[model samples]
Target: MSEIVFRSRFDNGRRKAFERSPKVSLTSPDFYFSHCFGVCRKKTSMGPPGIIWVASRVTQPDKLSEERFCEWYEGQHIDEVTALSGVPAAARYEAVPMSELAGPPTAETIKAAEQRPDYLMGGKWLTIYEMKDVDFRHTAEFKSLDGQSKPKGNLLDEIFTKAHFETRFGALLSNDDKGIKKGPGKLIISATMTPGSRASAEDIEQFYEREHVAEIAKCPGYVRTRRFRWVDTTVLKEFERLPADPIEPGNSVVALHEFEGPYFPMEGLLKADETPWTARVLESLKKNGIEAGFYRLKRVYGEWLPGSSKL
Candidate 1:
């Protein structure tokens, strides 16, 4: 087998940190098998290489009004993070209620819509941050800007006390652009899961690449599909005061399907999953390890213009 070597460059300070960290050969089968979902293969059309930080939260509305939370998060917090080096862009999303996802009231559609885990269902807001590299989070600039070590009494400190946050880090695997319009889709459906003991990471990647993604692309408003393999989980220094019980284990894989529309065609999504191959793969995922959510883009920050709010 041909060997593919992975190399990286960093400044002196970062080099020291990188050297101290555990090393893994990117060319090894074990490395590819463990961290990637077949995107490492030469045949695969890989997405823009980098790390994505997905952060979701549910804030106490009674203590801090929704208006206040949105004003602070959208107006202040997002800009602060994006201004940092290595962080290029960010987007925010709001959960779409089940009632608004118009489609046939069939059993299948209803079941599919309601099959999300509690964390996803309860996380009313989500933010996706695009980083230039995986080590960006560990840099001294990030740590200082994070303000975790700073004294309390700031607005962020107050907001953290009133909200429950969950975050996961994933490396980009594949980005399939199928939408007519450029940038992010108005609607996004996120599915996350861990493969069963009998199934391997490659098995799930092949399913999406060969079958599932194509099926969904045939839907009316299909825009693009992006896949990621989980890397790790972290608690923002702000949320450290809260109990850790709410922090859930991260899933092994995540597939995001973006759509352009006033409303997603729930019926079409159900039909796409009716194939026997999809059924077999889904069944092989560990029990209670799968979760999904439907969200509408709310705001765009940094490099991209703001998305439509009409959804």
Candidate 2:
């Protein structure tokens, strides 16, 4: 852990506090809410990081507006307080067409998209990014060199080459045809890495350095990226399981990259083409003696908050 450099807009005090204590209270909703509300209010005023909740659609699917969202819960709005408390700045990013999400959607995909915690980083539409950590400055490896000579071209790009890139031929048609709209076709790509026993903080830094990040960013159709440092905690059973008591982090850091192009990148034709790309990338990894990681993918509902100027 060379200092965790967050590419977010959170205030200094909150960032420092989270850095000091990354644990979230699981048992004490009241205490958690108070802290969360304060942070939310502060962020609302100063424009801090907005929290994204990642609840299962099956468990709690009906979407709610901010007012309703607060009403439905027993605890105070943690968004404001947490933002104020140095939990990292908070923001409310609503979906332009959030409700459009549907699926063979499974928990694995949802969990994959939410490489970080669902409580702090989740919300309606399977919250993806809070927009704070848009840069690729988090733990993840995007490259793998197979035993073959590291090719001059990327395996994925090669697979989706113009010659073989037609949808009929099992190529993913480009989203370029649909035109870029607010929430259409944006999917989240989440990668998680649990350091081996000997891994150190410095090792973490080297993993996400510019080289790896740039490659991930350069991946075929990435929209934006969000990286999260799990406040001290491990992977719990679900959002309802934590003790509500502030504690050490048990989970690993999570990095989310949004890929919103005209077509879905990993399905049907796209997936057909990607399979080989993945093989080549993995082979590359084996050759390079690097570890491969498990990844999750999700087609989620994301919206731009009302009156938000950035959309």
**lDDT of prediction 2:** 0.30
Residue clash pairs of candidate 1: 179-223
lDDT of each: 0.61, 0.30
Highest TM-score scorer: 1
Residue 12 accuracy (lDDT) in model 1: 47
Give the C-alpha lDDT of model 1: 0.61
Models 1 onward score TM values of: 0.72, 0.35
Error of 1 at 20 (Å): 22
Per-residue error for 123 in candidate 1, Å, reads: 0.8
Q: What lDDT does candidate 1 reach at residue 241?
A: 25
Tell me the tens digit of each residue's lDDT in model 1 across 1-311.
Answer: 00000111233465465457566664454333322221222323423344444544535667767777678778876787779776667778898877577643567757775765463545677777766554454444554443323323565445765665555656677777746776778898878877775354567878998999988998998888877766545443234422223223333777888899988877889999899888878778766557777889998877742221111
What local lDDT score does residue 114 receive in model 2, on the 0 to 100 scale?
Answer: 47
